[model samples]
Target: MTETIHPTTESANRYLRDNFAPVREELTATDLTVTGRLPDHLDGRYLRIGPNPLDDPGDQHHWFLGEGMVHGVRIRDGHAEWYRNRWVRSAAVADSLGEPHRGTPGERDFAANTNVLEHHGRTLALVEAGAPPYELTHDLDTVGPCDFGGTLPSIPGRPGYAAHPHRDPGTGELHALSYNWTAGNRVAYSVLGNDGRIRRSVDVEVHGSPMMHDFALTERHVVILDLPVTFDIATATEDVPRLVRPLVRGLLNRVIGRNPLPEPVIARIARGGDAVSLPYRWNPDYPARIGIMPRDGDSASVRWFEIAPCYVFHTLNAYDDGDTVVVDVIRHPTMFATVLNGPNEGPAVLTRFTLDLRTGQARETGIDQRSQEFPRHDERLTGRRHRYGWAVGFEDGAPGDTLLRHDLDTGSTESRRLGAGLEASEFCFVPNPDGTAEDDGVLMGYVHDRAEGRSQLRVLDAATLDDVATVHLPGRVPAGFHGNWAPEGADLADV
Candidate 1:
């Protein structure tokens, strides 16, 4: 693709310097708060580390925390309780070089550790720890670099982030896609063995922002959207001087606000290590959300869908049928301005797009409209044959928003408001394994009472959408971002 440079406006430059500089200064201050030491005491149920903690920081490993306190809830008989972990470890440390801070507490000492549960029933959690934690069971093998087939390059401090794994039906291989922000905006993939070993790693360059969301995977290939622009962390640090900071801040804001990467950049980046010129364009005011659908036999046959003008910074969920892929796009419409002014009155949407697998043709289902924030599907609700499910979240309206049940087939929506006082976050539906087919199962969500500084887990019947029970958590769950449900027999400890 040909590179084009758009002339930068003086007003835009002045806006960037004036409004964005302080944000970078504050981030620098936060970075300084990171102490390179773990606390003397960590009060947690269990802790697991990788094979070699002292190994090169770039090597991949696994760890577990709060293992004993983890328990799965069964909706059957209305008995909800925690089941303790069978194995217990008092206090275990990883071989990490820096002081460990629990991500649950929002400590900035280390990078966030994300757990991706693979489709082949293997749970692989990648801890973005600056230093490796203690080594755990030797039985859990280390995925050698050769297994990755030299597709991924390991950066020193910053490791790539991973999403939930997707399986390819044709190759019978588990494909895990990750974005390495530390490595010049590259996308990498690792093929997993049935025994849970890494089979291959290939580094694919994707332009735009260094961070990437979950990529779509099919039996033959992975699809990634290359966003243009470079993310400079030094500018994000607060310690930068006030005068020079404006320039840095302006650059950061412009890049984030205007995601300028084009389609050619995406294709070129996916083709492996190739240095492409950055596109010259106005600062990206919105976060770019790209949707991918992997094709069957053809490696280059992946389908790409882009949401223009509006950028998406939230999660992307998909439900696939034999011939088509249904994507759920949740966007934070006012995220850019919100960064400076806090939360504003902006709308979010749940867009459904149908992509033909064979032709790579994308047709919007005309289901685009304002909807709830962070609409997530229950794991138990998703299956190969099952196409219909419920998405629960607070809707947008005057007075107060209500919890909505969105029907995928009919494109009709139903909502129940939480009165004026109460507010709800995301919801999960847990199906009853032992219950009859007629019973749609249970719906669970958090009802946040900000005034009272309390949150309650509200459970309802999936079929009727009526309250079943409310489980009050101690010391407030602190308005979590996203969560998953673990059924009765499932090992919450595994998470």
Candidate 2:
């Protein structure tokens, strides 16, 4: 039996309510229920990570500031073994739960909340900005912060790595353009070798600390998106939500009733939050450009190409075509333009870009003008040319009941609209062992039922975008960021 469950925390913030709210405790359920035939060839685990704050931060809470919780489902021998959800225990989480802290001491109290993936032999929960990644055991317990066996060197307390790293399918190496807020104008172009340690790290000069969430990769070059959204001090100090602004202003006015505080003082006191959790916002003054750097060369060989104003949180895939670089991305018209509490600037659009290496010019083309984000393609096609892409759709900034597949070669789209009150998260493609084509595999991710108030693991045929099977989770997994299929091989614990 299932029932609709709602967050009991009192807050006017939509991010702290309904399906976006955090679950209170960790849970483990065994021998899960299945609605269809479980694919025996699919022998692996599916994991996802996102912000799930333990306590509400009230009106000042930002959606990206919460602690992380990882949700995983294990499959083996055609049986759904179990489902588990565990918080990526930073020091703050450990101290709150009364459990002793594990792992190397962190430079700051932070959340490893954006993504979870296995690199080499270690499973890591990763976040951006300055915080280091927290290692996790096979069962998802915190193993402590990892520094690539102390090879991912950082400056003083700053660990300059990104949450999104592009792995070369052919070489088994990982590539990233990472930045830290304190790093000022230079971002590192880092490459992790097959052994999972930083083999090459070069500091590439840029205008300022841009939010380098994700980038593009081709065979010979790494594409850097030095876009308009950037770090801003005023966004942290004064940007509050319009809905709750009156409540804050009224309270400040009542506090200084006898003395009558000045207008500037009242405004500052009303908008200020407890701390500077995330300081990034849309910056129009910053020029939007793309930097093309050789994978085999250094920062001295980097070439920059300017583009129109926009911001991107993710990219589908990129490849080299003759002397041009082709990349597909979900582009937002603007971000954090009117509100600071959450993303008020999208229903993002899917677009394709062609960059001429010789002329240093860029051409942007619209693929799908609908409201969609969280784009994914088969990992086998990463950093290379591909035919298809998949993403979860959003309607007017809310989870739309649609899943999409696009044929880049033909410019045709296929969509699978879900039943009422059912919302889907980012679906990742798992390749078939004997498959011949790109779409010859299964797509897997979470699906939440609003009426039942419980979420489930859903599998779909990638080619037709049809339902294949479902593994009901033990509880509701809040909407999250990114994850991948950790195909079963040698046990990860032994790796």
Candidate 3:
């Protein structure tokens, strides 16, 4: 169960302060206003979920650690039907909102606030921490946690799922590399069939409790990014006692590198790197690695490739060409290198790393020069080579007013700018009805206008980078992590 320690003070973290303040109230209104014409085929809900803590987030208030709330807008037949917002209804959040909690709190509460997607006919709220997903109805209400209709394997200890699971367009199979922080040096790879039943589960070995936020799933292999940023229990200030600092450090040292314990307990006390210092820290001794394990094989089939020490939170796409595997991602120089105040690092640029299986060498190159994050591609082209990538551009770590469309086939990019003082989130491409070309689709997502304090749903033509329409909303929806377009009465397609 989640700890019920009520923080008495407001958070000092940058993410919870200023313009990024959390919205406490939830509302539902019918017949939302539309500023421009919406597409006729755009008949579905546009849902985005992010952290919005209800109460004051005390000392350890990282932006990522706040409670999850989802904002949604429903559009049908070129008309705005309604807009609504609701918290995921976790145990703590339910108690705060005076609603009924739907499921028993596992080792960790279900934040369910990271990303929202429809898979196997179920809409799910997802987070990276070891918590089962909270299901949502088409109207955006919490339907409670799910376990693949009771077909998922019991994780034995702390059960969890990846917030960003990959689906293969060819087979409709969803694959996830689920990791549990409590289970140090261990991770699980699970495959769910098109029927939303667990098909396979394999336990994989790792060095420490590294944060594997995202991975690459190709047709032949699963790319594992085991980086240096590890989970240090000492950072959970509420859990660790003052007298246990030395004991924690000794145990951590042994777990990471198999180092011998120091004979004298109080030989030295360092400023950082000690277990009692930060909730999470960087491990310089750990070599950043990329493992390519066969899609159908076990952990023993993995082939390891070493890369420079860095951190990555997302990957756009990956494909295999002959003996080499090419993966594109947003690369950060370092994360939590010194302190985990927030993402104080420089802008994450779009970079590609190619791993050659025959030679066992990896080379990194720049895909696009612009600083961007939340990269996405046509779902039809996932796990294979195709053109077109879309991402939100960044300025000073905040999403800028432009959406970038990259044409990998032609080695060129086109950008569509939202109005000034407006920022756009990740956009999903909905293919034109019966369209054959990959770029023949409309990109739709949420765009917030800070000056007016309102947000709207924008649909853009994928091939021309032109604005097709904007369905306006009543209030500003906070910028979220990831989202997808769920077209009504249609299967998952590239449009």
Top lDDT hit: 2
Task: Score every model by TM-score.
Answer: 0.57, 0.90, 0.90
lDDT tens readout by residue for model 1, 347-424: 666665566666767665435364556454444322232334454353332113366666665667667766565666
lDDT of each: 0.38, 0.80, 0.76
**In candidate 3, which residue pairs clash?**
235-278, 235-279, 430-495, 431-495
Order of the predicted models by TM-score, top scorer first: 2, 3, 1
Find the 10 residues in a row with the least total lDDT in model 3: 265-274
lDDT of 3 by residue, 1-495 (tens): 222212212556656653356775687878876766787877878888887878876555666766788888888888889998888888777888788888655435656778888887788898874678888888888877777877653343332678888888877777888876555577778887877788888877777678888999888999999999876645633344568766766565564322222323212222232232235667787789999999878878889999999888999899999999999899988888854756657778888899999999999988888888888898877889867898889887777888898888777888877878788888887887779998898888888777666677888888887878887776667767788877676664322
**Candidate 1 stretches greater than 4 Å from native:** 1-78, 82-154, 157-159, 163-175, 191-196, 216-234, 237-307, 313-316, 319-324, 337-345, 356-361, 366-368, 378-386, 392-401, 435-439, 488-495
| Candidate structures ordered by lDDT, highest first | 2, 3, 1
Q: Which regions in candidate 2 have their CA more than 4 angstroms from the true location?
A: 2-4, 8-10, 154-159, 235-273, 490-495
lDDT of 1 at 194: 53
Ten contiguous residues minimizing lDDT sum, candidate 2: 252-261
